[model samples]
Target: MAEAARGLGWHPFPGPAAVNSVRYQNRAACAYHGFCDRGGCHLDAKNSTAVSTIPRAQETGRLQVVTEAHVRRVEVDGEGRATGVSYLKGGEEYFQPADVVLLASYTYENVRLMLLSKSPAYPDGLSNNGGQVGRHYMTHATGAGVLALFPHRLNRWYGLPAQGVAIDDWAADNFDHSDLDFIGGGNLWVYSDRRPIAAARMPTFGRAPRWGSAWKAFVADNADRWTNCYIQKSTLPYEDNYLDLHPTVTDPLGDPVCRITADFKDNERRIATFVQDRMVEWFRAAGAVEIIRQGLGTMGPSTHAYGGTRMGDDPETNVVDRWGFSHEAPNLGILGASVMGTSGSHNPTLTAQALGWRTAAHLVENWSSIAG
Candidate 1:
């Protein structure tokens, strides 16, 4: 891939060193033939749960795989302890009893399920005694790369996201932000994962009309000449930015959908502008012909949503304790990005997986104390 990049007479620089904490085999040194980011590895070379953890757990005779179970709520006994969960399979309802229960759903769903499960012991919501279940919700403010025009075809049709170059000089607290308006920072990514179908969709640099013959010609002419600059910025949680069950909106299962109320603040806008300046500097240094900067739009519910069930020692402010166990509901553990307190300007999946491991280990080490 480096040789192919150099063949186009490009600088082919390794922007910076960043480690990807993936559970699977390292793709950074692999052939990286473009499609690894999409439908996953065809050869099952990736170490996802389906290929790695699940199969090992299935080897144990005690593991039972229940498919198509839509969990409604975690049932608690009169003493405010989790007894088990109630879920739906097909059109019938079933109750599964257990000594301990872990809510491993995504950020929004984790809070949603907790809010949905109510009992006389805790009227407001499950584990919401201090009303902090959905507070401090946040997501990493994602910025797509500046759609830049390259001077020549770099043959960007090959390579994966893991094979990309990254510039972290502006990410997190790498540089001084005391004089700046924003408190957080972002990482700059330059990937060569240009698929043909995606490259054909670049806006025609105002050279031709957006529709009709001119548009078609422009796409064909500039398909290889266009690329992007991606920035993943650290976003801090605010009191107003939160997640809650939608008042009127219901899902197919008659449950309230998780409603997200978040948007990019002035701090993020300032950071985006600053990151754009730095990206332009790097791109111009790399011989980019044209750079078009974009804004940090309103945030939407993404896989990276965090902090709804934050983990901390204080029960008044956080939902889960430092070990991912609920402060109010004993034997109830949460294992997802929701327990995260900070947005680290990177993908949270690997960190969440590690936290899940830590939570499981903690449970096993203190099983007798917790379950009893």
Candidate 2:
């Protein structure tokens, strides 16, 4: 695949991942057991905070992790500064006070929590006096995939999702877009992470029936003879695409849930169509006898959700300042993809973590002024 991509003047390389390839920080390397896609790694090689950072923080004897607590809102004082957070635990409501508050929930919940925490000083919501809390929303333009069928076995039974070859020539501003209708491109990724149940569910490519003997025969023969490519495109925030508290639907706790009003604009559709063509070309070069292309469906709930509490220099257009602190609430900080203004052609996990470290460092450096 790398050779094929190189032949097309594209940059092909191994996809960057957080999973450990060798022993590091006392954690074992990835076992490549093929189930890393389904759940947490028993070997603790995935580099999740649970095994990496939290444990180290707990070792300091200063960090307390309260499990099963549902945070209700961020409590504020008369001056509209965050005092602490109120949460529900075991049917009892409790407030935990703090000198500084950092909201690190995923994009949706972060926005919802800020919106739900309405105060008399800030009548709209916490840090929402400028109405920018849930304004610039975005999700990665993903799910536009291509499946390829090969004639021989690919020996792809034991690999992880991060174990993949990637083509980044078409990803984000890498190529000239002088004549293109879209501004951003996509990253093409091909990995050999396959599971038995998902492999058995592969489409027959119109060569067999949907059930019975023919389907069984097809699955038996072609189970290991197919692979798919994931295309993650750059997505931009739009004015109309935003998140808000749902007016009608409420959760079990009688609080409104986060509502997403977003779709793939024409620019995104053009990028998907263009990237899919390139993907098909690459698959053909890699000896794919059959190729199946999926549509550029509407953006739905995604693990790569971004924005809602975007960071910027202007208070009128952003919820948080450049340091990830709330623009209106001085001591409140946000530490997640929710503060990201744009969705690049990659996963936001590393970027989010980097920002979290930066925000924490900033808080520590300016503790007297920020936490006063």
The numbered model that scores best in TM-score is: 2
Q: lDDT by residue for model 1 over 30-67, one digit each (tens)?
A: 34565566567654555467666777788897789799
Give the residue spans of candidate 1 off by over 4 A: 1-41, 211-214
The digit string of per-residue lDDT tens for model 2 on 204-254 reads 887889999989999999999999888998888999999999999999999
lDDT of 1: 0.79
RMSD of each: 4.2, 1.2
Cα deviation of 56 in candidate 2 (Å)? Answer: 0.2
**What's the lDDT for residue 152 in model 2?**
93
**Alpha carbon lDDT of each predicted model:** 0.79, 0.91
Which parts of model 2 are misplaced by more than 4 Å? none
